[model samples]
Target: MGAWSRLKGAFTRDAQISSPEDLLAQSRERRSGKVPVTNDSALRNSAVWACLRLRADLMSDFPIDVYRKVSGIQVEVPKPPVLISPGGSEVGMKEWMYSTEFDLDRGGNCFGIITERSGVIGPDGRGLPGRIDLVELGSVSVRGKGSTITKYVIGGKEYEPWDVWHEKQYTVAGFPMGLSPVAYAAWTIEETISAQQFARDWFAGGAVPLAELKNNAKTIDREAARVARENFRAAVDSSGLFVHGVDWEYKPIQAVASQSAFLEARQYGATEIARFFGVPGDLIDVAMSGSSITYASIGQRNLQFLIMNLGPAVGRREEAFSRKLVSGPRFVKLNTDAMLRMDPEARARTIGARITNRTLTPDEARALDNLPPLTDEQYGQFDRLFGPRSAPTPPTTAVPGASS
Candidate 1:
């Protein structure tokens, strides 16, 4: 335990608690010739936002199911009230899950204060969580001795570890807190943001090249030059005509390479961000070259994403939910079948094939499409269109010989 605690402290050496307002202010500040890295500033990049949103959106859409091992098979069980409405009557599980996942993706940690618990006792002396109100990470301070979190200070108020619900990902050995990917990707995100700002400022005339308007016949004085330059800039800025004398010549300096390089840098930043967030570049509309990968269908692409990118995150969440939300043999499963849903035509063919092969019942297939079972009239209609579904043939041995 002591060794584990020491390792955990090493990972969280710079841990500090601050208000959201303070974090936002710090994010706006420039420090040591680099943009201050914070969740808010990192999200300023469109690619970063897209990656986080994609993960959170998909993860939240997946339905949560509780199951217990029965006879060596997973049998679905009734979800605890906390799993159903984790945040209380005002917030459903989907919204809660989305918020939690968003935090995990951004900060690698999520903190919530348990407000209520069920009557059923869990492994911990406290009952299972009935309501957990998520707190902003900035407002929560985690204090631990070695690997054991002694307490949580949220909004300057203290609470026991049992009273605080914490989930972390991207973990290392003995670390109670997850490592923030944003922290590691800070330079990339900052570079992207700096490029964006440069582009904005450049278009706004901050970096416009100096131009000289000189008289071919006679040299102009400083005062005359300043007036002419101001007039020219004002006219250009407002899209007004700048009528110059024929004697005067205007030659503007142009550096086209910088603009082209800026564009390339921006593209590279997007691709890098996609990589950092474990999202496919194409999924976020990030252009990349020198790749020949292709997907036969959207389902195949989604399947690859589910397996490669989201699988581990989903597993971590499942483990956390199983350990904390349920007890004994019961476990939690986030149904990712929704992510792999095929197009209507493809889905129909697959379901039809399953029914034909006796792998799935007609009613069960209908349920997959969220339709109710067929009535007698519908069965009659089906029988008229196609022969009735054949019942399995009964096997006979000695009885068949006797009948013969």
Candidate 2:
């Protein structure tokens, strides 16, 4: 069964997990439909690592800045984990969200433990949470009341589930547990890893000669055997030759395994892993010899990637952060435009189109491109570029010329 289906079935089968205390114990035990994707080494595969890095870096570049609706327009908010850093440090919101989403993308679950700095308030008057800090899933466990998860246990301390931000992909068991792609696609990843290892081992040690010398007449004496061994070792290791006399025959060994097919399988597995992660095959340098997806142009492929793959992934985070980080009309949205942002001329054309269409004002388009609004004189200059907007005055009356 597919991982999602299996997860659903297992959750439904064990629908009786209602007791909060019991859930803590049950969570410690293996839950139904749980599959182990592998430990953290999942990123060791070059293709997986490349895809994940691309996704994470792309999403990260799309800022997760906070905004609130005021009189129908969204305004930036000041309070955030970091105050001024741009590229994002350990405490920066972008870095945190980027890493968290990386985990969700790869392992299917991402978590954060609320800290006092998070500013999240609890229902109780005195006891509550204010903010959250990203926490590793390995350090946290989920416990529930009935089918509903109530709390998460980290180390020995227990905190309400509401206090912990959990972002998951391929969710099952009431959204508390996630089904990892790595787990469901374990066989493919394993095959890729194996192939990689095989290649490494081949190049590392395959330098040795693949043959042995045999005495035709009889088994050589110890001295003769020793000399033969030395000669064979020198020939194979350094010179790639067989310097043997009569009665000593060298037979090059042949591999029973089909190395070519194995290598081809490895290449195939890389693309399959990329597919599982929704990455374009060509993005990872996989030969799309038979792929129908046209990678004809870099721009079009990137545009398609934004619309088809990265857009949804970024949207999920936007929703999650909107729900968890802010309340009411306020929302946290990633600047997805940054992902597919075109060159200056193209961008100007786009914004000009929007302005012409009246979907955006000239000022708003300028703002979107981070340009300040034009001054009155600058506006005149700018409008003049479109040429002679105003009509020329008619010729002065003949009387004025006569007076002169």
Candidate maximizing TM-score = 1
lDDT of 2 by residue, 1-404 (tens): 54445444444553432222222223332344333235366678787888888888887677667889899888998645432232134466557667876887776777776555334432333333344567665566665533566666776677876567677776654545665666656677777776666666665656344567789988778998898788778876796967556787777666446567677887898889998888987887885567666654456678898989888877777787666555456677777767565766777787788876779987887787588987889868867898655654567667655655
TM-score of 1: 0.82
The C-alpha stretches of model 2 lying farther than 4 A from their native spots are 1-37, 65-90, 117-130, 144-146, 173-175, 204-209, 212-248, 253-259, 290-299, 379-388, 391-404
TM-score of 2: 0.71
lDDT (CA) per prediction = 0.82, 0.66
Give each model a TM-score. 0.82, 0.71
RMSD of each: 5.5, 9.1
Candidate 1 residues 1-404, lDDT tens each?
34334334443564542333232333333457555668777888999999999999999999999999889999998999999889989989999999999999887889899999888788978798889999987787766654566777898998988998999987776656676767667778888888888888777767566565778988888898889889988998899998987887888656587789898898999999898888999889986977667878899999999999999999999999999999888999999998998998999899889987889998999887789999999999988999896878877657655655
Best by lDDT: 1
